[model samples]
Target chain A: MEKVLQINNLSKNYGNIRAIEDVSFEVKKGEVYGLLGPNGSGKTTTLAVIMGILNANGGSYEWFEQPFSKLSRRRIGALIETPNFYPYLTLWENLKIVAKIKDADEKDINNALGIANLLKRKHTNFGHLSLGMKQRMSLASVLIGNPEVLVLDEPTNGLDPEGFAEVRNIILSQADAGKTIIIASHILDEVEKVCSHVAILKSGDLIANGRVGELLSAEETVYIQTQKPEDLIKSLKESDLAKEVYSSDDDVAVVLNTDLNSGDLNKFCFEKGFTLTKIQVRKQSLEDQFLQLVK
Target chain B: MKKLFNLEKIKALSYPPFKTLMIIHFLLFFLVILVVSRIHFSIPGFSVKGLYQFPNIWEFFPWVASWFNIFLTIVLITLVGNEFSFKTFRQNVIDGLDRNDLIKGKLILIFTIAVYTFIMVLIAVLIFGLIFGISLLF
Candidate 1:
C-alpha cells in the first residue's frame, strides 16, 4: 500500500519541556492508524506538529507524499477536542456551516447529517443536545465533503455505548471506502478495536510501531496438552522456542517466540511415546503489548 | 476569500439566538418608526417639532451599530482565546487541519462576525433613510 502520511524525526518543545522527541512513523493509505499514548506522552503534541498547529523544533512530515499545504488540508477532515459550534444553532444548521466552510456542495449537508445519524435532530439547537449527540455533530463536520482523510482525536469522547458503536461503524465504512484514518486516543481498547496499524508513543518518543497484529503478536505463547506432560516438559526445556515452560494440571504451557514449530514438538512427544492431545496457540492482546512496550 | 466569506456568513446565520436577535432587532426598530409615524398622522394639527428633528438621534443608528460591532469584537476576542484556552486547537492540528487551515478557519470566523454586523447596520441605515425621506415630504 502507498504511504499516505509520513513523519520523520519530528520533535517539539514547549518552553523547556520536550513534547515530542525524534518521533518517526508512517501511515499507509486505506488504513486506520492509531497514535497510542498516555496523557502527557505527547500524542496531542505530535498531532499538532503534523497538522501545523504548532511549529516543530525539528523534523518534517508529508501527506500522500506531497508536501503539506493548505490545499492538502482541505482533503483532510479532523475533530480535535470538543466539537465547536454556535450553541444556539441546530444540528443541521451547524453542519451546514461546516459544509460551507469545507467548500462542500450544499446538497451534501443532508448526506453528512445522515451519516452522523443527526438527520432527525436537524432542527435541535446544538447546545441542547446531549454530549453524545454533540460529539456526533462534531464528527459530522469531518464526515462531510467526503474528505480523503479523517484525522480524529479521541473520536469516541463523550459518546455512550450506542454512539460509540455508531462512530466505530462510520469509521469502518470510511476505511472500507479506502479513506485513510489517523486516530489519536488514550483509550487502548478503542485503538485496538479500530486500528489496522498502531504507533506507541512514550514520553515524546516513538517506542513501538507496526501492523496491529504484529505488535499484538510480539508476545506469543503456546499450550500443549500431552499424556507424558512430564517428559514433554523436559524435552521442550532444551528447545530454543521455549522462553519459559511450565506444566499446569494436564497442559504444558510454553511461552515462546513466533518461530516455534508445533510439528517439531509433536514429533518429539510422539517419539517419546507421549500422546499429544491438543496444541493451542495464543497471541498477546494489543493492550498487553502496549503495556509491555510502555513499561 | 470569497469562499471563506460565504462560509462565515453561513455559520453566522446558523446560530439561532444570533439570528433571532437580529430579527427581533429589525422588527423592534421598525415598530419604533411605525408608532412614531402613526402618532404623527393620528392627531390633527399636532406639531411634531422635535420628533425627527433631533439630529443627534440620527447618529443613533451608526452609534448603535458601532457598539454592536464592538460587542461582537469582544466576543470574537473571546472566541480566539477559547481556541488556545482549551484542547480543541491542539486537537484540531492532530486531526490534520495543519497550521494554515487553522489560521484560515479563525480568519473566517472573524470575517463572519464583521460581515454579519455590517449587513445588519446597512439594513438599519436603509430603513432609517426611508423613514426620514418619507417624513420630509409630509
Candidate 2:
C-alpha cells in the first residue's frame, strides 16, 4: 500500500516546553491510524503539526509522498479541537459556510446532516445546540466533499454514548468506503475499537508503534502452578516459549510471547513429566498494555 | 478574492448582530456626510453656510468621510474578530481554505469597504453640491 503520510523525527517546542520530540510514524493508505496517549502526552501537538496548523521545530513530513500544499489539504478533512461555528448562525448556515470554503457541492450538506441526524435541527442556532450536537455538527463537516483522508484530533471528545457510537459508525463507514483516517485520541477504548494501527506517545516521545492487534496481543500474562516449583521455573527458564517468568506467591507467572499458546506451554511442561495443577491465561486489556508501555 | 469576499459577506449575514453593526456603520456613514455637508452657523454678523460647494465639497468631503472610516474599521474588526473569537479562522484553514485565502478574504473585505465608502462619499458630496452649491447656480 502507498504511504498516505510519513513523519520523520518530527519535533515541536512551545517556549521552553517540549510538546513533541522525535516523533516518527507512517500511515498507509486506507488504514485508521491512531495517535494514542494521555492528555498532555503530545497527542494534540503531534496532530496540530501533522495538519499543518503549527510549524515543526525540526524534521519533515509528507502526505501521499508529496510536499504539503493546499491541494493536498483539499483532499483532507480535519477538526482540531472544539467545533468552530458562528454561534448565532443556524446549523445549516454554519455548514453552508463550511461547504463554500471546502468548495464542496451544496448537496453534500444534506447528506452530511442526514448522516449526523442533524437535518431536523438544521435551522437551529449553533449556540443553542447541546454539546453533543455541536460535536456532531463539527463531525459532519468532515463528510463534506467526501475528502479522501480525515485527520481528526480527539474526534469523539465531548460526545455522549449515542453520539460516540454515531461518530464511530461514521468513521467505520468512511473506512469501509476506502477512506484513510488519522485520529488522535486519549481514549484507549475508542482507538482500540477503530484504529487499524497505533502509535503510542508518552511525555512527547514515541514510545511504541505497531499494528493494534500486534501491540495488544503482545502482552499475555499467563499463570501456571506445577507440582514441582523448581522444575516449573527451570523448565520455563530453559524453554524460550515464555521469556518473563517469576514466582508470585504460590503460582508462577509467565508472559507468553507472540503465537506461543498457553496450551502448548502447558503441554510442554506436562511432557517434561511435570503435571500442571492449575493454569490461567490472562489477556491484558489495551488500557493495561498502554499503561505498561507508558510506564 | 472576490469569491472569498462574497462568501464572507454571505456568512456574515447569518449573524444578525453582525448585520446590525454593518447597518449602523452604513447609516452612520450617510448621516455623517449629510450632517457635515449641511452645517450652517452665524455668530454676530459672521455667517458660515453650506460646507458642500464645488472645491470645498471635494476638499472637506474626503476629510469628513475619512473620520467615518472608523465605522468601517470597527465593523471590519468585529467581523474579523468574530472569526478568531469563534475559532472559525482555524476551522476555515482546516476546511481546506489555504491560510492565505483567509487573509485575502479579510483584505478584500477591507478593500471593498474602503472603496465602497470612498465612492459613497464621492457620490454623496456630488449630490449635495449639485443641489446646493454656489458654483453652478451663482
Candidate 3:
C-alpha cells in the first residue's frame, strides 16, 4: 500500500511543557486512520504539527513519501481543534475563501455545502449559526477541494446525536470513495466504527497501533465463579487454555487464548473436577479497551 | 498570488467592520478638507483658497490625507488581528495556504488599499484644483 503520511519520532513542546514527545504513526492510502486518545493526550497537537500550524520540536513527517509542501497540502483537507472561519462571512462566502485557497472551482462550494446539509443556510453568517452547524460548516470546508485525504480533529465536537450520525455517514461515504482519512478523536465508538486502523495515544506516546479488531476486540475475557477460585485460577494458568488469569473481585477473570473459546475453558474446568457456580462471557467494548489502554 | 488575493478579498469585503471602517475613513478625509476649505482668514497674507488651487492642491490633499492614514492603519490592523483572534490563519494553512502565502495575501491587501487611497486622493485633488483654479481665472 502506498503511504499517504509518515511521521517518525515527532516531538513538540509548548515553552516549558512537552505537548507531544517521540510520537509516530503512518497513514496509508485509502485507510481511515484514527488517532485515538483522551483529552490533552496530544491528538490535536499531532494533527497541528503535521498540518504546519505548529512546528515540531524534533523529528519530522512527510506526505506522499516526500517532504511536506504546499502542493501536498492542497491534496489534504483538514479541520483541527475548532471551526475557524471568518465569523462575519456567510457560510457560502467562507467556503468560497477555502475554495480559492485550494484553487478549487466555485461550483464545488455548493456541492460541499450540500453534502454537509448546510446549503439552506449558505447565506447565513457563520457566527450566527448554532455550534453544531458551525461544525458541519467546518466539514463543508474540508470538502472544498475534493482532496484525496481528510484530517479531522474532533469532527463531531458539538453535534447532536442526529448530526453525529450524519457526520459519521459522511465520513463513511468518503472512506467508501477511497479517500484516505486521519481523524483525531476521543470518541472510541466513533473511531471503532469509522476507522480501519487506529493508533492509541497516552500522554503523548503511541501506546498501541493496529487494526481495530486485532488491537481492541481480539481478546474475550470470561469471568468464572468456582468453589475454589484460587485453585481454578492456578489450574487455568497451568493449562494452555488461558492466556491470562487474574481475579476480578470474587470472580476469576480469564482471557482465553486465540484458539480456545469460553466453552473450551468451561470444558477444561469440568475435566479438572472444578464445579463452576457461575460462568459469564464478556466481550470488552471499545470504550473498556480504550480506558484500559489509556489507564 | 491571484488565489490568495481572491481569498483575502472575500474575507475583507464580506466583513462589516472592514466595510464600515473604510467608509468612515473616506468620509473623514473629505470632511476635513471640505471644512478646512471653508475657513476664511481675516489676515491679508493668508487664504484657505490658496491651498485648494492647482499646484498647491496636489501637495495639500495628500498631506491632509496623511493625517487620516491612522485610520487606514487601524483598518489593516483589524483585518490582520481578526485572523489571529479567529485562528483563521491556522485554518488557512490547513486548507492549503503556505505560511508565506498568508503574509503575501496581507501584502496584496495593503497594496490594493494603497492604490485605492491614491486614486481617491488624486481624484479629490483634481476636482478641487480645477474647481478652484477655474474660479480664480474668472
Q: Listing candidates in order, what is each one's chain A TM-score?
A: 0.82, 0.86, 0.91
> In model 3, what is the error at residue A158, expressed in angstroms?
2.1
Which tens-of-lDDT digit does each residue in A1-295 have in candidate 2? 9998999999999999999999999999999999999889998888788888899999899999998888888888888888888898888888888888878998999998998889999999999998888888887888898899988888789788998998888888888889999889999989999999999999999999999998867777888888788778888888888867777679887887678888888888878888888899877678977876786
List DockQ for all candidates.
Answer: 0.25, 0.62, 0.84
How much is the TM-score of the A chain of model 2? Answer: 0.86
Could you give candidate 1's per-residue lDDT for residues B20-114 as a string of tens digits?
Answer: 56666556655665565466443555433234434533565555555445456555566556556644455445433445666787688877666
B1-138, model 3: which lDDT tens digit per residue? Answer: 787778888888887888988898899999999998888764687578999997888899999999888878998999999999999998888888878989999999999999999999999999889988998899
Per-prediction TM-score, chain B alone: 0.59, 0.79, 0.94
Q: Proportion of native contacts found in each model? A: 0.39, 0.74, 1.00
Mark the 10 consecutive residues where model 3 chain A has the least summed lDDT.
Answer: A286-295
lDDT of 3 at B1: 78
Ranking by lDDT: 3, 2, 1
| Local accuracy of candidate 3 as per-residue lDDT tens digits, A85-197 | 98898999899889888889999999999999999999999999988888889989999989999999999987888888989999999899999999999998899999999
**What level of docking quality does candidate 2 show?**
medium
Q: Report the C-alpha lDDT of model 1 over A1-295, residue by residue, as the tens digit.
A: 7888999999999999999999999988888999999888988788767776778999999988989876777788887656766665577766666665566776777887888888898888877988888788877788778888988888888678898888888888888888999999888888988999889999999998888887766667567897677777888788665776776457787767456566666666677687778888777677756765687
Alpha-carbon shift of residue A236 in model 3 (angstroms): 5.7
Q: Rank the candidates by DockQ, best first.
A: 3, 2, 1
